[model samples]
Target chain A: MQRYFIDTAMTAAPGTTVTLTGEIAHHIVRVMRMAPKDKVELVFPHQQAYVAELTQTTPTVAARLIAQLSFNSELPVAVTIACGLSKKDKADWIVQKGTELGAQAFVFFASTYAIAKWDPKKQVKKLERLQKIARDAARQSHRLVVPEVRYQKNVTALCQLPKDQGVVAYEEAAKAGETAQLVQVTQQLKPGQRVIGVFGPEGGFAPQEVTQLNAAGFTTVGLGPRILRAETAPMYYLSALSTILELQTPVVQSAYSE
Target chain B: MQRYFIDTAMTAAPGTTVTLTGEIAHHIVRVMRMAPKDKVELVFPHQQAYVAELTQTTPTVAARLIAQLSFNSELPVAVTIACGLSKKDKADWIVQKGTELGAQAFVFFASTYAIAKWDPKKQVKKLERLQKIARDAARQSHRLVVPEVRYQKNVTALCQLPKDQGVVAYEEAAKAGETAQLVQVTQQLKPGQRVIGVFGPEGGFAPQEVTQLNAAGFTTVGLGPRILRAETAPMYYLSALSTILELQTPVVQSAYSE
Candidate 1:
């Protein structure tokens, strides 16, 4: 079922009127064609979601709470996908897919090898659009939490992640170990811990980049025998990480974007 | 480090004449634009591979072995990928990528919901073409095995996997357990095991299909929280499996690809 996030204040006990705002209002009323009495799920951050039906339309649409208390699909491990900046479509794909895969946050870093440049003035706007994608994907995938999407200056600006473990995906790291990637990552991971992973752009990381990450205590790792396209590699790790952390393959109605 | 598979026999000696035939000959001569004395590597099935330099050309190029050693890049586990035939070039992408990820075999089965159809007479030719793709991708990814590209009768035939461990990649499966996918697959897997994993078309498998797999000893699994296009799921699994099996990341090098 398609669920929308709303403010906790908007929700009332069992049956009451509440208004959606901004993008949510525009999306529910305009894009999705949702209207009066149509049933949908509304979630408030950190609270159990409720089933609501559209009751009215105005500056924002009004919905009445139909049901409360239920299960929401949330991953056991909170995943943070930190990706270097890339082409527009590719970046869009990463954000959308990463959200659907249970990413709690995404860090977009502009790297030395990145061909696409972002002007400082427009960086915030650019990030907003990407965040919109994450919000939409969260609803579609029935996620309990919508991913926090943002931008970073470079690797040094990497967020002080709340994750128990973090990994830097560098292909060259393979030569140094037969089981180094798994060992480092597995060691850091305790069951039910959130994990953050980083990936480079198409040109891959400079040798110094790996050294820097190693110095920062981010364990470098490789994917496998094949050379995956830059976009594919991080997504691959997200799937595996979620599997390990959650301890099950989640099968729901397929809901995601490119 | 581009390695060519030589179907022809090699003399067990230092100085000898080895003829390159078929597509390999065409690629070396026309594509690589090689003249005499160009260094290359060739491997005979179940034999030591060697470094050889081109010695002659025209119809068939001859090369002399410069060095010989037992070499292999085969993964410990043998993986078979069965995908529902799809329309939007996704199936082709799966074949190419799965080959690179060390899938030992591939089956393009016609599911009840499959939109792509093939004529009976051309099945062999189609599989042959797909086989060539696997061969090319194998060389590019430095895989020791070329996935056996084949087709199945339909979903009925597919339900009976001619392999040991079976997995059906259904988004629906992931929801049933908090983390059943990785737990189930990991529990079943041991070193050097051969397993078959199935994926559905964009439309996905029916409830009956999931039940059939359960009855037939196949576990229903979800790729992740994301709704991957039909092509991306299997590749995601293959990449993760490689990491898990190897217990480490792979070395990335530009020299290996064709």
Candidate 2:
């Protein structure tokens, strides 16, 4: 079934007719050509998903709620991927893949050794584009929520953001054979906690930058022994996190359970 | 410091001058512009890494072996990422990212639902390009070995390839709440074992294809609840494997140890 995220909430009970307007309505009525009785998923605000059957498609695209979906695909813990500004297409790649991998948000900041700088004039446009990518990826992945994309002026600005825990993916940590920090951090994560992971650019973090992060309460950690490129580190982190938090624990019985 | 993978083995003892030629030499001389006494790491055929000091940069780029490196970045278990062929740039993206994530090798095969088909005439050139990407990524990630990229005609060809164990990422498994198989398989993996992970294309595998793999001793596993792109699945598998096989165990003291 096709899924669409709607801006408004569906407060009425099941069997109530809900009309979709704007882009989503055009997509359903014109692009998908969904007709009466065709089932589609409508995700409303607050991450509620419902299965709705199309009732009227001629004058407007509308559907009546069948039932709510119970299977939640979101990560148990919310992760904000904070990365140093990098060169072209990397940020876009990160947002798209990160959303698919269950990140709750993404933050790009200029660090001491960052090679790319977001132009003040073009920052909004770039962020909007990234946000769109995240939404598309989220929809494709059947995620109820789209991860937000944000920009921080510098490392200090990134540090000011609130998170339950913060860890910086420092190359020096990996080079120094620091292997336990990342696993240790993940082990400490509890459900619903928000954690931020900081990563560097192609030219990794400077010594002083790492120091500042350390002073600001971010633990320096290594993803592994191998040198992951700037963009690869976050994916590794998210994957490892999901493995540890989701797969390793006792199975959560949900609608998908046999 | 720079790293290069050399074609020939260096059997000479320390202090003996070894000459480098071809692309490696040109990269060290023209690209890096190194002078005498500069240090570089040269990896040999059997994954031997040695630090060498430049003897001369003139006639040929020559260096004297300074010492041998004992730190191995390769995963404890060899992982071959077998992916159903995807559309343009996805294969390239998978090869590069998979190399950094410590996949031992890559195999692209035509599955029942694969949208992209490799032209027989263009296959070799495409493989070469992917192999180059693996090499560059290996160098960038300070890997001891470059992962070999291969093409298989179909699922049977992929299954016929030797591996101690195999797991296929199945969307149905995830939807059916099959989460234990992957972690169970990872837990069962022993050091030095070879494991292969299979992923579907954008269109995903047909039901019969999954059955065929299951008959071939490939256990179906879920990466997570969220639907990951075909290329992203391999990265998740590799990263999760590394986390389970490398980070969860006791840290091995290496050269960087204090």
Candidate 3:
């Protein structure tokens, strides 16, 4: 079944029908060519996924909620990857793969060493495309929620976001063989807490930027011994957190029961 | 300093000169526009990095090995990523990023659900491009060894590769909430042991393919709750393995002591 993230809250209870209008309706009628009686997974604002059948597809697409699905595919800890604005394709790659890896949000900020400069006039279109990629990736990955994607004008703006813990992926830390910083931080995080990890551009964060981040209470952590590229570092952080919380802890026991 | 992988065994001892010829020599002379006294890191067959100064850049490039560096960036366990053939760009992405993440080798095999078919006639050119990507990525990441890239005709050929342990990243295992299989397999691997991880194509493995892999002694493992794409799955596996064997185990204490 095809999946779409409905913008509205869950208004249709089981056995009730709801109308999906605007862009989503056009996507179903035009792109997907879906018709009446076709099935789709409709994820609502509450992150609840419901199997819905297309009741009508003419003027507007409508579907009746059949059953509520019971699965939590979100990570135990919500991860926000705050990366310095990289080149065009690299940012797109980060958004797509980060969503698939269960990231909750993505924040792109301009650091001193940022090579790609975003145009304010085209920012809307750029953000829309990135958000669409996140939605598609979330749907492809069967994620309960589509990660929120946004842009920060500078690192100063990024430092203002509210987060439980903030950390920077510093290559210097890796060079210093600082292995325990990330492990120690992730170990102390309880379920439902939020963590924001910052990464640099290809030229890397400047000394003043690092000082500002450290002053803003961001702990520096190393991914490993090898130097990961700008886009690869965020995915590495998400994977490590997943290994620590999801694999090591074993969230659900059904598979292990055997 | 710029880095280049010299294609011969380490011939010169410390404080000795080595001749660089062929493509590497061409790259150094023409592409890099290097002159005498330029510094470069020379990675040899022994997988050791040596700081070498350019002694000659005329007809052939020659450099004097100044000192033998003492850093080992290779993964504790050698991982070979055997993936089902994907689209051209995705396969390229996997090889580039996987090299940076410390994969020993890459094997692309045709699977039951493979969307991309490899032509035997073009195999040489394709393999050369991928190998070049791995080499460039290895140099950029300052790695000792450039991962070897190869192609396999089918899944049976992939199964015949000698490996201490084999695992498959199965989406079904993730759906069943199988979280501990990969962790268990990675935990039991001693240092320097070879592990091969198989991944599926866009449509994933067929039921018979799964059975075949299981019968061939490949343990099916889940990469957490959310789904990963064909290219993303292998990087996730590599990242998790690095986190386990590198960060958690504390491979080198020199960088940590400061």
Candidate 4:
């Protein structure tokens, strides 16, 4: 069954019919050629999923909520990826993959070395396109909610975003073999805490920009020793978070002590 | 300074000169527009990096080897990524990002659900192009050597590849919350041992294909809860390995026990 993220938070009790409209209706009817009796999964605004059975297919599409599904695909700690605006394709790639990897939101800002300049005239259109990519990716990945995408004019504006914890993926930290800060921050993270990680553009962050990030409470951390590309670093950081938070088993010291 | 991977096992002893030919020569002379006395790094077949100064830029580029630099960027354990052949661009993305993340080799085999079929005539050309992508990525990431790229006709050939340990990134394992195998395998990995990981294509591995991998000594391992795209899974696995082997500090259980 195909999955779609619905915008309105309507009750999906077992007997209620939900009508699909706008682009989603067209997608189901024309692109997918879905007919009455076909099945689809609709994700509600509050991040709950329910199976739906199509009841009507002409002119518009409608489905009845069959059952509610359980399982939170979202990460325990919400992560917002803040990147210095990169090339167009790189930005799109980050949004798509970041959503699949369980990012809560994505924020892009213009850094000192950002090669791709954001046009003030086209900002809304560009942001909308990126948001669409996130929605589609979230659907494909079976994520409960679509990650919010936003753009900022510069790093100063980016620093204002609220997060319980902030970290920066700095290449110099990798060079200096500074690995403890990430571990410290991630270990201190509790479920539902918001972490915002900022990465530099292809040219990386300038010294003054790093200072600003430091002043704003973002600790610089290394991904690893290898020189990851500007685009690759964020993925590395996100994966690290998942490994530490989700995958690793807790250390039971008694066994080791013996 | 720029870095170039040289094929021949040439000595880069101090005061000795090495000549660049073919594509690498053109890249230095034409693309990079190098002048005499400019510095460049040369990586030989032995995986040693040397700082060299341009001695000649005409006919064929020549450089004088100044000193041998001694830092190995290769992972403690070698990793080979075996993926079911996916769409053309996805396969390329895997190779490029996998190289940057420290994959020692890449093997693409056709799974039962693989949508892309490799043409016998174009295999060599395609493999070469992917190999070039890995080489460029290796140089950019300051890796010691380029990862080897290979094509296999089916999963059977992939099973025949020798490895110390084999693991599959099975989606079902994630659903079952099977998190121990990857940690177990990576923990027991000794330095220089080879580990091969197999990932499915867009449609994923069929039951019979999974059985085939199991028979070949591959242990299925889950990445995490959220779904990962075919290209993204291998990078996640590699990053996990790096986090375990390179990034994390060993737990001091004795101190905690007290």
How do the residues A80-112 of candidate 1 rate in per-residue lDDT, one tens digit apiece? 888888888878888877777667888888888
Docking quality band of candidate 1, CAPRI definitions: acceptable
Query: Candidate 2: deviation at residue A170, Å?
Result: 0.5
What digit string (tens of lDDT, one per residue) describes model 2 on residues B1-258? 799998876575677788899988899889999999899998888888889999999987889988888888999888999999898699999999999999989999998899999999999999999999999999999999899999999998988889889999999898887777887777777778889999999999999999999999999999999988899999999999888777743333222111
Candidate 1 — which residues are off by over 4 angstroms? Answer: A6-16, A21-35, A56-60, A68-72, A87-89, A112-129, A159-164, A175-177, A190-194, A248-258, B5-17, B21-72, B115-133, B190-193, B222-229, B248-258
lDDT (Cα, tens digit) per residue for candidate 3, span A78-191: 899999989999999999999999999999888889999999998889999999999999999899889999999888887889988899999988988888888677777778
DockQ of each: 0.24, 0.43, 0.45, 0.45
Please give each candidate's TM-score: 0.79, 0.95, 0.94, 0.95
Query: What lDDT is reached at residue B179 by model 1?
Result: 42
Q: Where does model 4 exceed 4 Å of error?
A: A250-258, B250-258
**Fraction of true contacts kept, per model?**
0.37, 0.59, 0.60, 0.48
lDDT of 4 at A201: 93
Decide which is better by DockQ, 1 or 3.
Answer: 3
Model 2: what is its DockQ? 0.43
Writing each residue's lDDT as its tens digit, candidate 3 over B152-225 gives 88888888899999999998899999987887777777888899999998889998898888988999999999
Clashing pairs for model 2 are none
Two-way lDDT contest, 1 vs 3, winner: 3
Candidate 2, residue B206: how far the Cα is off, in Å: 1.5
RMSD of each: 7.5, 5.1, 4.4, 2.7
